[model samples]
Target chain A: MKPVATIEGRAIPLGLKNLDTDVIIPAHWLKTITRDGLGKGAFETLRAEPGNILDDPEYAGAPILIAGDNFGCGSSREHAAWALADLGIAAVIAPSFSDIFSGNAFKNGILTVALPQEAVDRLLEVARDHPVTVDLDSQTVTTPFQDRFAFAIDPFRKHCLSEGLDEIGLTLASSAAIGAFERMEGRPWLVPSASPANVGLNGTIA
Target chain B: MASRPRTLYEKIWDAHVVERREDGTCLLYIDRHLVHEVTSPQAFEGLRVAGRRVRRPELTLAVPDHNVPTTARLGADGTPLPIADPESAAQLAALTRNTAEFGIPYIPATAPAQGIVHVVGPEQGFSLPGATVVCGDSHTAAHGGIGALAFGIGTSEVEHVLATQTLLLAGSKTMEVRVEGDLGPGITAKDLILHIIGRIGTAGGTGHVIEYRGRVFEEMSVEGRLTVCNMSIEGGARAGLIAPDETVFAWLEGRPMAPAGEAWDAALAWWRTLATDPGARFDKSVVIDAAEVEPTVTWGTSPEDVAGIGGHVPDPDSFADPAKQAAAAKSLAYMGLAPGTPLSDIPVENVFIGSCTNSRIEDLRAAAAVLDGRTKAPGVKWAIAVPGSGLVKRQAEAEGLDRIFTAAGFEWREPGCSACLAMNPDKVPAGERCASTSNRNFVGRQGPGARTHLMSPAMAAAAAVTGRLTDVRALMAS
Candidate 1:
């Protein structure tokens, strides 16, 4: 979960649009609660094909995937991200991703890099012959041909990734602040319960 | 201060608002947290590291459905299928362990009463009107059949609900969809929803919450409402809701979790008020003729690209919008269907009539009605009917529905999401087309190179018998 400082790898190009989570890892694979062993089932049907990218020796151990537009659509299953991570895909280059999928991927320490279609086209071309490098520090994706394309991630996500902080991690990091808020309980000051319902229900820990 | 009157949605929305932030998101209190075996493990782990307990154990429930195999009776070596795959077994085991540790109720996979979480929620009366319910499963919107403010949340949201019993929301606009008159004899709730979706188009209800109203909805059985609401997501609606009425109360009156006697009376009194008022305003409205809905089916990829069976696939060029035309053309080519080609001529290799959407007892009966004394088409690779829950499975068997299915050369299997996405062993092989009761027919949804034509259960059954996507109306009329 370290802040992904840089990503350098080959791109296994999956040139399909609206690749939903059902297609990514499938609903059946979700029956397992553990995040383990999902790599085997990720895109099982696709892998079943003789020359699928996952099975193709040429793309073996690729760390980047260049997907078509509207990738990661459908059910907001986090396992989709887990499966991709387990498959060693560190970054996904797409025109866009489903909002929920991007959030899940970000939380799991996978970089979802959005780029212009032209840049994506170029990278896809470059991907056919050589590895690509993505540097989070510089926010740039570079090709072995010395071409570099700058990208952006949400500052908050960048911070979270840099700090290895999840929602709970961030919340727990503010334990003292939370303790101070708790001490404000019963006082006639400092963020009283918003509603009468909240008098019993909101953050009252009991 | 502004003093605008509150709408029913606003009242209910405000009642559940636990906290609000500057970002304009309301942290709403969730009263019921329903979890299935599939989506709870990670959330439980998130809690363990935090050293926290489920904030409100009494308000949570768990069940297993997604991974349970229905028809794989034994292994190649003749041993019983030891839960088919290890992942599902581990997930189920984790659910059992977590529910036990948290003192929460869990309906285990092998339990005679186990089934889909959504079906069990209302059938057992655990989901009530005017309360907020959250489940890790997306189809949790199925609980909205009770007029509850129900929504499906992600696993992180699940963890949030477990620890805080609340979720962040940006709220949603309300739309009233009114259906009048009675449905024609052969038409079912599945057809009605398809008719609505066809008219509204997918993404019509984006950022809105739909309240299904009118005499048609009022008269619908709970199962019917669930069938309609289950596909709300398909229509791109945040959620679908129906107000609680006498029918709602009656449906929940004597179930396991329903309040008894006086408490039930109090609950009913409150539930009755969950409806929209006479003068309540909606952001949008749509009306449909209940009688006009036929045994509808989807011929193309997206749900909105559907038309009534016996109708021709529409010509892309006829549409003025280029994007729409492109989409239609793509769907037409992928489905191997041409413009003006009657949908009835579309041959199919498989027929699946089961999923959280259309696999209830009522759905089974409807399919059985069509398949009575009929046999499946020759050389069909797969034709099966899967019930949604264990209760439906048992009820179907007790009533000889299973025998009718078997007699018709259809496989009657245990309850799970069978062939819905063809994720497990049940799948349509590459390039095979199928008639599916489950929602979504996106390319390869059932399996790689598998084509799915979404239809009602009866239509699926009719297609099973005919080996093609035949119009059920023709079969029904025959």
Candidate 2:
């Protein structure tokens, strides 16, 4: 994960609503074991269209994306976030987002800013001609035309994004607490007995 | 001292909280973790790179389903056949090696119990009442039907749970969707959920965990509830819950992984108390009349672009919002549909009666009943039935559902996510329309440029016989 403080660049104004993960990176592109090189497949379908904004040279490698409501609405695949990060997008401004996508984006250090539809619409207009600035420290998205929009994000997520924290490392530090909870719950049935005899019902190998 | 009334979600959250931060995020312990091929490889690699061992390998189960071919897995000599796609084969091999290296219990691709992760979790009793289940796939919410607080996670969170057995989380708001009255004949749980998604657009359930309330859900079978809860993600809810009751307990009692004897009794005692308390308030509420729901199907790409089977393709001009209008027009163009055309008049070249949403035994039986003596229409080139699990496949075979399907010109396939996402060999041809029982109708979900119309299993069977999207009720009457 990379730290994201302030990003200033032209924005890809993909203001389409309900842009799902399937559109972000198709299932065929998901066969790779590694997360690198996904940017080439990011928004593959939309970019296939001639003159699409994602392919437009003006917004190439833009650090910010202005989108419509309900962005990243389906699938919990983090590939959507990885694709965006690989595409050099550090922040996404949408009126709303799917819960899973927001969490996935935060984990990858991609800031998801939830602004009003009017604010997103304004950004979409300004982004066509000018560069936009997203300051995570200030929790605001500003444009060259004096447009400044404040957005709400979970403080914990905001902190992690700005600091580029490794969430797995942070959670591991609380392993003692986790063990204590496990002991206190005292539910043996919750833990399945490890039985190697049950590996495969037919016991065949490919 | 009396504590405030708590919703089922609140009770589960409070019970699982190990430590709470001042910012309100908690280190919540996860009870069960389900891993599949596509999402777990990267997470396991991360663990290997970091020299991390799975904290609770016993609590995790790995099964390869997404990229596994649904066709024959074994050859004439009873040896497992190789997967043709190199990328898919490599991905599956990675899972096999990672699970073994990490000491996680894995069900091999040739295992009889190996299936879709969501289906395998409940079928094996790995997902139980009052438990927190996490999977790398979005359809993991289907396990919530058994009273688990389950939701999908990304690979990063997957690695987090594998390493620490807990998640850093914020509480979600509770929303109650109360569906009252008796559902009309031919109106299945799939229709009810499709109707719910149609009524409340995809974003309606965002930022909330929806608890399905009222007689409609209470009377539904456990399998039906799973189908309803399975699509909670499609409605933008991370998870959907139906209070655990005798129905869920009965369904789970004799499963291979369920507790038995004294442990079962103790588990039942605790599970009975996992319901929402009286006077508990929800952050949001949606009341629906069950009678209002019809045999529904998607008319366009998005799940919300749905209508009753009798309805017609809506004109984009009918939409009030310009964004919605443009989306509808684009969907129509992609789907090759004309405005004002009756939904039933739309011809389908393919029929797919399987997915996490509708691939269980009950779903197979529903499709079988509709195809009892009928044959596929001449114009319908392909139709296949993929069971949710090997156990489900065996049960259906025992009940002769496979024969009924094959007799009706539908192929009886192995248990896997075949043609659902088209990650495997099963894919609808480009430019072809399929009446599918799967959850999503998104563009290219089945295959690149493939058009999907979501419906119930019986509706899919009806489409197979009619070569068009026909109401199952009408087929039953004929």
Candidate maximizing lDDT: 2
lDDT values, one for every candidate:
0.75, 0.89
Separately for all candidates shown, the number of backbone clashes (residues 3 or more apart, or on different chains) is 0, 0
Give DockQ for candidates 1 onward, in order. 0.14, 0.54
Residues B355-389 of candidate 1: C-alpha lDDT, one tens digit per residue: 87899899999899889989998957778898887
iRMSD values, candidates in order: 9.8, 3.2
In model 1, where do residues sit more than 4 Å from their true spots?
A: A1-17, A28-32, A36-71, A83-165, A168-206, B1-8, B72-81, B180-182, B284-292, B314-334, B379-381
Docking class of 1: incorrect
For candidate 1, give the lDDT of residue B2: 22
Error of 2 at B71 (Å): 0.7
Model 2 clash pairs are: none
TM-score: which candidate is best? 2
